[model samples]
Target chain A: MHTSKVLVHNRDRSEIESEENYLPLNVLRLSKRFGGIHALNEVTFNIEEKSIISLIGPNGAGKTTFINVVTGTYPPEAGMIYFQGQNITGLPAHKIASLGIGRTFQLQELFLSLTVLENAMVGCHTRGRAGMFAAGLRIHPAKADEKRLREEAMENLKMIGLEQRASDSISSLPLGERKLVGMARALGMRPKLLMLDEPVAGLAAHEIENLVRLIHSLIDRGLTLFIVEHNMPFVMSISERVIVLDEGFKIAEGPPDDVRANEKVIKAYLGE
Target chain B: MKNSEIDRTHIPFIIMIAVIILLPIIIPSAYIISVMVFVAVYGVLALGMGILIGHAGLFSLAHPVWFGLGAYISGILAARGWVSPGIGIIVSAFFVALISYIIGAPILRLRGYYLACATFALLLIAQIAGGQLTNITGGHEGLLGIPPLSLGGFVFQTDLHYYFLSWALCIGCFWFCSNLIHSRVGRAIRSFHDSEIASKSMGVNIPKYKLQLFILTSVMASLAGSIFCFYLCFTVPSFFGFHLLVELLMMIVIGGIGSIQGPLIGSFVILWLRELIHIYFGKIFPVMTGEVDSIFFGILIIIVLIFMPRGLAGWVEQSFNLGRRTYAYFKGPGA
Candidate 1:
């Protein structure tokens, strides 16, 4: 049986501990099995606030499974997930999201009928206080709340350089711009932890560059980023630490350079 | 789509409402006004079903059940002298909301065909009860003597009077539904229509939202039913079964499924078409009965699906946008 493997590169910055520096995401021995196959087995990691962490692996690696479990898309078969020190194991997707975990899909699951701004407004549902009665009747508080949400959604679109496209329907947007719209929608949630699954996949070089810049800007705005990407240069340049997985196991863990050079990770990606 | 004051988009809706208001006065015929009242009642049903089927991507055949139950509740209560027709309408809406909420919690979890089947079964069961529950419902003899709705010394006794009430109910439902679709709740419902996983990732409680929509639409149907009962002053056990459900579906589909305007338009067309069928086709096809009605609608739905897949509302939107485009083209860029 393949148990566990961890290669830690203890940076000097870990010594500078403070009350605000507590780990925002901590996954311990998380395991998810899809029938006879182990999508993720005993995967453990922690992410600090305001830093970018990349999860890289081969085609069958459990990066998406990890995200699905963390976001409560699927109940983990084993282990626990702690977000801001609260045990969020097996919570419903919406409950976990309300606790400040926002995610963008790899393939982009935008609301096709809504405009870009309206799509972002859907992301602000948890922050809304208006019920069906109030909204149906267009009462005062509901109107005020809706106005605030629209402004918030507009702000997010502006942050992602999509204010011009706010009125455009999402299905009409190009793939790269749609990816950015996905980011803008997620930003509407005001999440402390933002997870982006393959933000640069299928994007042109210029779009990738824009995304890289936007990714850094997100960290500056005080968000912790968890990215699953195949673009090595983008991941290596952006990630402070990179975790590698293969065959449902954590094969390598450290800075991007170390993982790039690791024998096991090289074998996992290239061949024996 | 912005709801700002003096929005240009609202002009058409305002004009449409104006037409509705002036319709009875302009026509001056008892028969036309009577048909308009039916259109208004069906308008409420279709609007409720429109939001569910078009925006939310849900299918349920139980709308007729909600409408029937509402008519029965208000009619039975008022007939028994237990309450006023006004209070009965209120109580009927409340109970429909509550009953649908509880039933929808489990039933709404079933998606697509399963949901349709479940709701259809519910309609059948309620229809059977209306026929079987003899002592209370008057059974096959039908429930009669349902008094008209009154408000503080004002009694609605005439077709013209009921026409206003019914149309007001329909327009009011449209106003609320329109506001809802453009609001946070509306977007939340539409979000799941395309991508459930994406909506869920954004912290949308899918089941909760679905159930809430189910409840709201059920209440709308109930109101339509309540109005129908009072307008007729009688309701048969066979009323509001599959035929009524198909009529509501036809209204939404013919008008357009997604836009509230589509169904509003659809309800009018359908009621008028039914009148035509009754006047002309009823004379020609003397052998026609319940079976012919189904075939008529089935073929009508197929024709609409083939030629006007988006329905009349969609066609209206397309031409509206096209007109705007042409105007802008002649006006030049950035005008």
Candidate 2:
């Protein structure tokens, strides 16, 4: 299997060019099982570097499970995951995050008790080096690092157009605004590869359009995006490439127009 | 984005500090001074616990073990003339911190009730060790003749001096704690309390932060214990036991769980309530019987938990806002 991949790479050198530049995330035969159910079965795909890719499928089609596996929330039963040419399979969530993979939750897990700014500031955890003792002493270096983090967090909020709400409590925000805050927080991590789980699931039409535009801006800044969405129109319009899953199997993968017209994708969604 | 340099929430804290400073002058009674000293000692202990329970969202029953270790180590060293009380306090705190880190590394892996049970087991182990290690601890008979803390030539011989010392220590810990919570590290710790998974995804090392908080609180508790030993000039296993743990826990919960002022205010309220109950009910109810005081304490806790779920700090903040509104109304809108 490995030799076949190598042979294909060599043959397609003219078209694909460098492997590292072409693929930021590559999964080989990734499988996950829960008891008797196969949540993901030998799924294989590679996400292009600096491109916005979408994973869309019906509920229970293992869309979220795939994201979970990629983000290191759940270890795959078999196969390897490579991010930026490094095997990151089974690494803990925080370790994966530090390696430049950031994600937002589908249910919007904003730090509700904290201000929006503080919520984003938490994403600066990996970047800041000051520990509890240094913070307690209010040392010169720690203070400087904190000021930098605050400024950076504010910048992220501004990018998300939530700078005005930086000091507002997260609990006071509407669901759509809170979702943006989650994205802003993830962006604060300085992730090269950002995975968004159901980014437009419960958003209003206007909010969905706003998120679509924001994602485009993010991609323009040289960040790779892996998005999971059930919103077909939003996914179709925003993504350059779309992958279709059906009951733990990838039924289709191509440009949005091709995937949308694929017989397998239509049958998988229509259940005939 | 109104950049008010100072947090308005600190107004109540300023008032509290002013009240504490004026307490000794207004009363000047030896008994009152001693009561205030007890409040300060427990305030320090509870503030440490607050960082764990309130900030880090961890509950440990083993704080008394660290507290007892502090008192016993200081007491033994002072009695044997091996070290000065001041050095003993610092040494004991480091020792307890080391033990807490070593034990906490593995035990903190268990979450919620399991973590609570593991720490409770540690408390029992410490109790057993205290009873068995008679050579140093003096066992149940207790270690006596522990010298009072002195600075160079001046010894803290009076309750007044000890009162000032304990409060000074409490205030210093409070300052350090407030600085910590407002800093970047404190924000990460608070993030853990809200959602561990979210915190982890944000690149916060969950286990490392938890263990750091556990060790820090343990060291703070140990320092309070050392001061407690010097203040009493003696130590016993019973001094650091389940009752003290319960009282300290009550202080943080009743004062406000996550707020800095919560533990301090909680400590003052609990101690004052216990004293008032002991004095007034001692004659009316059976003097030796524990039922009346226990019943009253239980009722008071129930009322506070039900009425002011966020504790006294939350209640005070609400009332402070109310007071502002009333003043604004009386001063005629524009004022």
Candidate 3:
């Protein structure tokens, strides 16, 4: 229903007003090249605030490369990324993250040696202000800060129903649970936009359902989600808008039903 | 559960403190006391290396260079009566900290074996500088007659006095390190170690944390070297050589790489084993001489690696958990 309100690219006052009211992320003329191969070629898009969107492409369609460039894992050869209407292209990964962008890896990158609680607490690194000296001396304010950090981490774990397993080592958790932990950790950053790379890739049907429900709850809380996933049914069911990519080209972009009906998307998935 | 975890972690630290206090009273032999003093000195150095290698996962072979620099700086200052031994320690620590930051800024950017090779090159360069800078270092003949550490009226002259002083300093360093490892920065260091990508995504500045830990480790190593110089009332280039570096590395590996108690326990184990091997092997073999100790140490380390890959602290922790589980099993679920 919210996708119906998305403005088409135009200079009209009504379109400008709609863009200003909802747009949180805008990537323009993003391009990345590896030697002779163009991994991403002049791709451009904008994400509305608090909207759940899915990016779907066949293997090697530059989906991962696009995410990497946007998140500052790899700098785009040419492009500008604007978050909340400010230029943020080519910043370092940590700086980008501190600017309210959080991401999870395709293969879960949980701190395996640390406990679930600690892994989530690490996500709260940007929020805490206590320095090494303050922490080492056990300064009263630092202690209180640490207490608050723990509570916040716990609250994040609870969001994904993982607070009960907070003290368990990450290595002890199952794959599905580990993915949830990764999501919880990202949530701990309190990011305005959460980017998930293949969040439901290895989950069972029931687990996928649970994750979809959790994601819906997160969207309801005014958090925007940019999901890159291969599961078309799940993506179509949950994402208000779906963007299709084919070999680094933006082939289709619209509401899920409209994009599903596009011949280019069908050809991209079924092959030429 | 939180209270119980804190109590469990503190047990080893409390036991270590009790052992340090009881050792001099129980032994009282000057030879044994001096040997224990060496353990405390080396333990401090190993703890520094442990923080670098264990927490940050950086392999720095140039630790002895900082250690040597600390000793030579303190030795030169004390010999000239420019500053007291207390001031010497603080001055040398800051000096090393500054140098390490400058060096680490570039070096910490590198990863794995490249970083190791770069640091190793630094060690060789420092050793050469020690010999070539004859006016300052005294070259191969070594700096001598550095005055005993004293505070106004009291002089730390005897082995017993130095023993308590070194252990006290060692304990203080341990307390600082333990506190640091539990702090927010420490968590960031460990997270970076486990997953650099994840840590960076969580807004942890990887290079900044690595360089900070590197500087901290260097400062601690320098302080230990200063105390070691005062303990012997002299300094030597040979004291801060490749052999000592290897010994410091062995202490961390043998004690348990990441645990707080690992370096301290490792220093005691390696030093005691070396002494025992030297004393007994000389009498038993008669012909093998000093070579037997190295051969035995090699074999012992190999055996330790094969049996306990995580090191002694890990083994101790595993057994501690096993004990707790068995006790709970006998007590039943509700009890």
Candidate 4:
């Protein structure tokens, strides 16, 4: 299959060696089939720390399915996943999250009843070491931890330009601000890897521009980002590498420039 | 809508604690003191219910099972000299927590209508046990000679003394539940209420939090029940019947579900209304009867539900927000 397709700029040996400098996150022979349909078929990829990777595809192209598998939302029927050289296959979503994987939903799932600060506090659950009894009783350690947590939450909110909205209930926030809050919550978890599902989808161009800047800021802070997005321009501008899938099969893999020019990717889109 | 300047969360608690503490001094009657004592007891029970229903958003009416079980357990144990009042109270709370954990394990797995029905059935079963188990429970006649709770040589015999004791316990419970709602567990409970799937995905063990809240609330309810039995120096299985269960449930609703103030406000409103109607109508207008008061309270509850769906706490919060707006308006555009 590799020979049948025209080789589109495969990495040189020196470049591949340099790329492997950081620990590689491995998705091994992953396959997920729902009855007669295969959402992801024997797809394998490696993501290194401090790199921005984009998963691009047409509708029903299993971009989301791949994200789900990586994030442990969907347990792969056959495969292994290793994060930082440790096996994380078949771990539950929250366990995966606690293991330094953070995620934002396609549609934001916020604590509508709680204030913005409180919503971010929920994300700090894993980092908290206070026992429930101690917290309930407001013991000295619990109080100190709470003060630190509130400060951390505030710092994250400030980072997202939402410090003023801290006490405001999340239900009242606009969609763009809510998206920012979701990102802030994920940030509060102190993740080594952050997966964002369409962070700028359904936003105005200006909002999308703002989100692009925010993503870049997070990347600058040394967060590994895997973004699933439909806005090709936004993905192309920031993504260091791109993986294209069509009908659950890897169609092309290269730099954004190469992937953008690939005939197979163009054909997959045109066929839709 | 972005008025995040003020912290109004604890205002209701402050006002409530003030009103309850000053109630006896203002009322100035032995009979009224007795009524206030009952209000404090009701406050304790409602506070427990408030934690589960208000904070955790678990719709349960199993107050009587916990309350009655604690009352009977502590009463029987203390009366038999198995333990002193202090130890018995501690043991009662512990036993209630244990029982709630066992019962909640099975019942909490069921949600919505199934949960309500299951707990309702549990209440019925407790009521039946109270009626049929004559040898141990004294059946409908109830257990008698429940010794008064004493800290040393000092027993709470008078309504004045019991009222102080009850309010002290009420304060302790209020502090505990308030602190809990602000804790990580409290947030987890609220998280489950808001979004169970999201909570699970956040590394919160859903069943563990639910059971923890259930057991905690159960222990609180039973502690109140045991204290009530001790204070009255009399116990009857019927004292913790379905009627009391409904009343306790109504307290959470009338006060405001999910708000900490709901239970205390609900208990006062309910108990006061009942007493007012009982004294004035039953004594003066004999034909009105206590049954009329039940109907009256029912109408009031319906009205509250129709107009103020968020209950009294919501109303107070609305007005408080309005007050802030008015203040801002008076401050003018320049300020």
Best prediction by lDDT = 1
**Which residue runs of candidate 1 sit more than 4 Å off their true CA positions?**
A1-21, B1-13, B289-299
Show model 4 residue runs off by greater than 4 Å. A1-24, A31-42, A58-76, A244-253, A257-272, B1-22, B283-290
Q: On residues B165-282, what C-alpha lDDT tens digit does candidate 2 reach at each position?
A: 8888888788788888988889989998898878889888889988998898888888888888989998888878788888888898899888888999999998888888888888
Best by DockQ: 1
C-alpha positional error of residue A230 in candidate 4 after TM-score superposition, expressed in Å: 2.2
* Error in Å for residue B101 of model 2: 0.6
The residue pairs found clashing in candidate 3 are none
Q: What share of the true interface contacts does each candidate keep?
A: 0.82, 0.73, 0.69, 0.43
**TM-score of candidate 1 relative to the true fold:** 0.94
| Interface alpha-carbon RMSD, every candidate | 0.8, 0.9, 1.1, 1.7
Chain B structural similarity as TM-score, candidate 4: 0.92
Model 2 lDDT tens row, A50-132: 89999998889898899889888888987778888777889998899999999999887777678999999998778888988
DockQ of 3: 0.65
lDDT of residue B11 for candidate 4: 62
- Chain A TM-score across all models, in listed order: 0.92, 0.92, 0.91, 0.89
What DockQ do you compute for every candidate structure? 0.77, 0.75, 0.65, 0.41
Looking at candidate 1 chain B, the ten consecutive residues that score lowest on lDDT are B1-10
- The DockQ-based CAPRI class assigned to model 1 is medium
